[model samples]
Target: MPKTGVLIETENGGVKAINYGLLTAAMGNKENEVIAFITQNDAAEAKDDLAAYGVSKVVQLKVGSGDINSSPDLCARALAAAVEEFELDHIAGLATAPGRDIFGRLGAILDVPLVSDIQSIDYGAETAVKSHFSGKTMATVKLEGSPVVFTVRPNAVDPVENPVDAETAEFNADVADGPKVTVKEVKASQQDKMELTEAPVIITGGRPIGAPDNYKMLDECAEVLGAAVGASRASVDAGFAPHSMQVGQTGKTVSPNLYIACGVSGAVQHFAGMKTSKVIVAINNDKDAPIFEKCDYGIIGDMFEVVPVLTEVLKASEEK
Candidate 1:
């Protein structure tokens, strides 16, 4: 088995590590060691969870005043240094946008093949199944050399609370002498409601919901279920929902415990954000919708009608 060094990308969503399924997956793998390199920005709040996930050592580096996500070179350099110092055999991270950025730079700097966006990672003598090529094909990879970098898909693996004795090591990491990009302004996305990624329960609306006003029922369902409302890219692009509510690669990655889909068609782009949910329930008009395949349970009917019924039943269940 290989020793795994996991980097926790920080600042915006310290919640990212808790949401991604790999934290549990890594801890469950007996032979793989989990290490976290946290940016100074999130060093305090995010450290405990990393430790709980079996992070052998947590390294902290001050990122100055720049955005960790935008500093691809600096991010990669820090992680690469840790890998070299620890002689780590494998490195893994979330497949989020910032993760992708750092993965490219780290792969280039480490001069190793990056097996990213994996659905499952099993360490044998030296082999694993990584679902890429639109999740249609699996690549059986053998990490021929040391420091194999992997970016795993969020929600693909289940995050388990595996507590371990953690050691926080404060280190002055090697940062890039010069930065390629400058962060002139950092504007956090503004929303009155909860962040979709942070929500424990999510109710996502898809294209067939008709219009934005129709969200009343979806909202009602979410309210009854005590969930945050979300939307598909198709619905967001249609102006039915705000971009913050979008669930996909181009949007926020969500790993809610319970995810309910209404009127969604189940596009791969949509499922990529929510497939890792603990329990998925899809309600669409068509039985053949792609979302049904990914759901643990599915309902075939119009969401407009189905959601209200569900809302009432859920509300009643809560009372009982």
Candidate 2:
């Protein structure tokens, strides 16, 4: 009856569906007796999707949280209590911004390892998969103790639709002594509203594409694939594309299902952002490009000619 606990985000208009994917990865091949801890902000939005992520139990944590600088550590400690109460084997949270603070506090107090930025979780093996060496490699981490704490990257795992009759319950996740270090003010980024990392399909252009004008072909192909546009650092720095769509070590790391890299040379930094994509298709004139090493399929040709053909084929399929 190996099971785990989930820490769901309910505040700041956060989505709780990511927790389901985290839970699915952590509680693999175990009894369906896991608990999910969510806050008020996301409660309304995250309800139906909890089961879609394979959570068997829902524990909505109520603290005087919402529109206030509530202590994330307090919520984390409360979830720690839930792990003890429900007797779960692991406690998992997201690797997003808020999760960084929550997991940091909980890991220290609980005296357990906090696995962060995990890309996958092997429930049977009790191993957590994380990107390491700045996304150059993947590392599988195992806890040395019980009730392990972990924070996972968003869009890391494919959310499983394993239906379970979940028993929803409310719990007190309030800590007696609040956060040692409190967040006084909030500073939000005023940039492009949409995050390309979370987009289902991402199409990125790299240095090999050569000129700024050539990227339009890549963009056209992206439109054909119904994918968001992305660019490697070289493409962005060379003013071929905007910084917002940059995908690499100094840019947004994406975990899309379908990643089409046109003219990318596959630097370690570039792969850091898109290596997690389920299907990688690389198109380059040079057959020796490093991107070919990790691509599911490769095409040796100029993207200028190849992308147009692909766009036409996709458009024809859509028309049908």
Candidate 3:
């Protein structure tokens, strides 16, 4: 069995729910031995969650007496050392901002190829599938290396629970932290916006949303559904939403369980960003909108009228 190592990501001091999906991808055909690599987290607290997802081993990678949080390069080098020490056949992580940075540096340090933003993988064949040209094409890439690296798109694959008692161990990499860069202070986003890539449900507004304040309608609906709010590029361009809220080939990519596109015309550019959503619900006033052709469910109605009713219904359902 191939020994696969998964770089675990955590939020609020616990394993992020999205990491379980990467665990599923690393498992592939269920023959690979899954080993989880974690840093700055209590292994005992994380073991149960990782074990539920079939992780056989939990290796806590630490650098020195002080925390390695300020040094990303040092962290990557440490992870590379762990990969070699464990003799892992393959390694995978979520393609989040931090993961991308660390995995890219780790690949460079290891002098190996790093495949990123992959939708699916077949470790048996050493191939992974990635969407190209704004999701218009699917590309299968073959990786060639002793221990290949892969960064899976968040929420791209569903998590499966296999339940194993994962053993824990600690590794202290004896590598020096070069003074090249020291993270002075880490400031998180002040806004409470849910991460677009990891949100289970997203409610998006399009150009017809009229103005920025109009997003309040969607916000109300999203609050009821526990969803993040997104916007098409057109809405961003028109100043109806900020660029951070934009979703398109030029913006953020999302793979939520449910994507609700309100007043979105569904141009290919916008569709490319959210095509992987498990279920898409499009609401547009124009019956001939192209989104109708691609969405799993389509409603032809004015968003102004439909959204309030929907929010009320959801609120009523919650109350009941």
| lDDT tens digits by residue: candidate 1, 1-320 | 45677777554556464333666655546677776777745555666767776667777754444545456777777778778777788887877666778888889888888887766766754665665444345688875556778877665676666777777776565565756755456676654565576567999888887788887777777777768899899899999888878987677767678898888887777776666678999888888988787789999998878888988998888899
Query: Candidate 1: TM-score?
Result: 0.78
Best by TM-score: 3
lDDT of 3 by residue, 19-118 (tens): 9999999998798999998886887789999999999999898886556666778778888888889999998889998899889988998898999899
Please give the lDDT score at residue 231 for candidate 1. Answer: 89
Against the true structure, candidate 2 reaches a TM-score of: 0.77
The whole-model lDDT of each prediction reads: 0.73, 0.74, 0.90
**lDDT tens readout by residue for model 2, 1-320:** 76777777653576544565667765666554566777665443555667656667777676444322366666666767777777878888777667778888788878888888788776656787788887877788886567777887877876766766666777655556646566677766453333576567887788766777776786677767767888889988888877887998999777878888888898888888888888999989998988898789999998878889999999999999
Query: What residue runs in model 2 are displaced by over 4 Å at the alpha carbon?
Result: 9-19, 40-46, 65-74, 84-87, 123-125, 176-194, 208-226, 239-244, 301-309
Cα-based lDDT at residue 176, candidate 1: 50
TM-scores for all candidates: the values are: 0.78, 0.77, 0.96
Model 1 alpha-carbon drift over 4 Å, by segment: 9-20, 41-47, 63-70, 192-202, 223-237, 242-259, 265-280, 285-296
* Of candidates 2 and 1, the better by TM-score: 1
Q: Whole-model lDDT, candidate 1?
A: 0.73
lDDT of 2 at 318: 92
